[model samples]
Target: MHKRVTFDNKLLPYLLVSPQILVTLVFFFIPAGEAVVYSVFSQDAFGIEINFVGLDNFLFLLNDPHYLRSFGITVFYSVAVAVSALIPALILAVLADGVAKGATVYKTLLIWPYAVAPAVAGVLWVFMFNPAVGIVAQWLRAAGIDWNYKLDGDQAMALVIFAAAWKQISYNFLFFLAGLQAIPKSLIEAAAIDGAGPMRRFFTIILPLLSPTTFFLAVVNMVYAFFDTFGVIHAVTLGGPAGATNILVYKVFNDGFIGLDLGSSSAQSVILLLIVVVLTVVQFRYVERKVQY
Candidate 1:
């Protein structure tokens, strides 16, 4: 049974949450409001002339083939990163859980990448795959494969996806390891005594219990791929091989800052926010039904 603590002083409760409220207002609501306003208006790069454009920016985006291509690219990139990150992390967690020796050391090594900045991770991957001097590139070339992300759009997209997935693996591993450890050993032992094999116990007993953690990670990884992968894209591909890796967040930055299309950029940001919000809502609505807890 959980006890519900009642606050006698109403003002104190409000004060306790005031800081968070203030932060949300300042950082989230304020910027979102600004984006909404800017999205509806067109302004010169210098801010000297402002004009009301209404829905022209959004309509332009809808008609623009490049923008549509970017939308498709973002969906594919997010799914690839989430799946790649989740599967390897789950495998590593299961393996680590079965280890009888040096478990802490193995877990520590797996987690070290999570501490590295996304940009640094991207740089590391970029160096390993660089066409001129990269070791992996040399190996690929030796294997009769032309390895140049700089010149190939599909190759550039794949490289960024790998980098992003690699960066997120450690985070997913931590959660999965924790979830695995929390599962009762008695259940596994009972199943084994009943003549269940390792694979059967895992799929029927362990995997079902880990569903909640998996679901949570799915949402987090999707959000990370949508928004937090900006650094990886920026450092690795810069949305190139002709904008092949231009996911929505990076597109917002590129359009707003580089292209000097503030209205279009703001519209893109609004649309991106809507996308993430909708994705999150859909996950919680439909996916949570599968979670045991």
Candidate 2:
């Protein structure tokens, strides 16, 4: 039998929890409700007119080629950001875990990047890759390669992907380092005594033990790529160079805020919310099967 904590005063429990409940209702549910309402109604830029259009906003999005393109770009961008962030961070974490001298300093330096804001990270990269004055771009031009992200769609996409991934790497690194440290030293030593090499031991033991952390980070990284990188894209490219880097989140901003298509933007946002929900559910349902503890 499970024992439940009893509250002497009935009102006390509700009072204790009231603030959080009120905050959630006001910020989350209320905004979500407003977005849903706005999605079904067409509104002019000045908000002088808001006509109920039923599902027309959503239908327009379905028929819009730019919206379709943004959807595809979002998938690719999310995958690339997740993979790039996870793998390099894992490698750095593993190396840092094995470090004995200056370990604290090493980890501190690695974690510093996470403290930088996404917009700031974008600006930093933009300066480094600016075709006219950037050091990296100048070097590329010297080597006979065109390095103008402002003019080249592929280059613009690449720049944003790398910037976003770089920003997330420190976060993934922290989690991975913790996960690495949690593995039992005895298990690793036993594996070594059994004639397992470092690579073999990692693949056979460490990787399996780290699966749970890996799965959690994967879900978080996907969500980050979907929503949190908006600042990066906005600051760096503004989804420019022929909309090459216009992932779904940025597209919503571009359409709603920049293009002043309020109804269409709201529809896009609702769709994005649904996509995130579905992706999270799928991750828990299928991906969690691989998680080991």
Candidate 3:
């Protein structure tokens, strides 16, 4: 049975949580409220005049072909990043779990990439893939492949996806490794005694036990790909090569600051928030059913 401890001073509970509540109010709720208010109003780029234009901004976005294209691009990019990050991390975690010696050193080296800032990671990739002087670019040229991402839309999108996924792989590796380590050795030994091969034991037992961790990582990676990848894209592609890598979050910044379309940018933010909320709800509602714990 679970035991509950009651506080003698009821106000103490509220006081204990007050700091986090204040932070949420200051950072999240306040900005969200401002966005909702601004989204319904039209404002000049100079901010000299403002006029109420309820739903006009959202309507314009709904009808804009560029916005529609961006919506599709963002979905594809997010999926690619999540999949690419998760697969390699899982493989690395599995390999590291089997190491009998130097495991700590291997894990430490694998996790060090997570400490790198997203922009710095992007810059690192950019240097390696730079068309003029990059080592990888030179290798591609030697292989008779055109390696310029500056002018190629598809190449630019692929490059940003690689940069973003590379940054996230270390984060996923930590969780996957933890989950792998938590599984019981008895279960694997029992399966082996029952004539189960390594591959069969992994597929039937280990993978099933990892469902919960996999589900959690899926949600986190999706959110990260959607929102946290802005710095990487900014540093690397700047959402260019004909706007191929222009995801929603970056578009919000570009529209608001560079284009100076406050109303539209606010509306886009609201919409992006809604999309993430809905996706999270869907995952919790449906995807969680498959998780073991």
Model 1 per-residue lDDT tens digits across residues 1-293: 99998889969988999999999999999999999999989999998999999999999999999999999999999999999999999999999999999999999999999998999999999889999999999999999998999989999999999999998999999999999999999999999999999999999999999999999898899889998998999988999989889898999999999999999999999998888789778888888976898
Q: What is the C-alpha lDDT of each candidate?
A: 0.94, 0.93, 0.93
Question: 12-86, model 3: which lDDT tens digit per residue?
Answer: 889999999999999999999999999999999988999999999999999999999999999999999999999
Candidate 1, residue 104: Cα displacement in angstroms equals 1.2
After superposition on all CA atoms, how large is the RMSD of candidate 3? 1.4
Off by over 4 Å in 2: 1-9
> Candidate 2 on 5-119: residue-level lDDT in tens?
8879989989999999999999888987888999999999999988999999999889989889888999999999999999999999999999999999999999999999999
CA deviation > 4 Å runs, candidate 1: 1-4
Give per-residue lDDT, candidate 2, residue 256. Answer: 89
Q: What's the residue-level lDDT of 237 in candidate 2?
A: 95
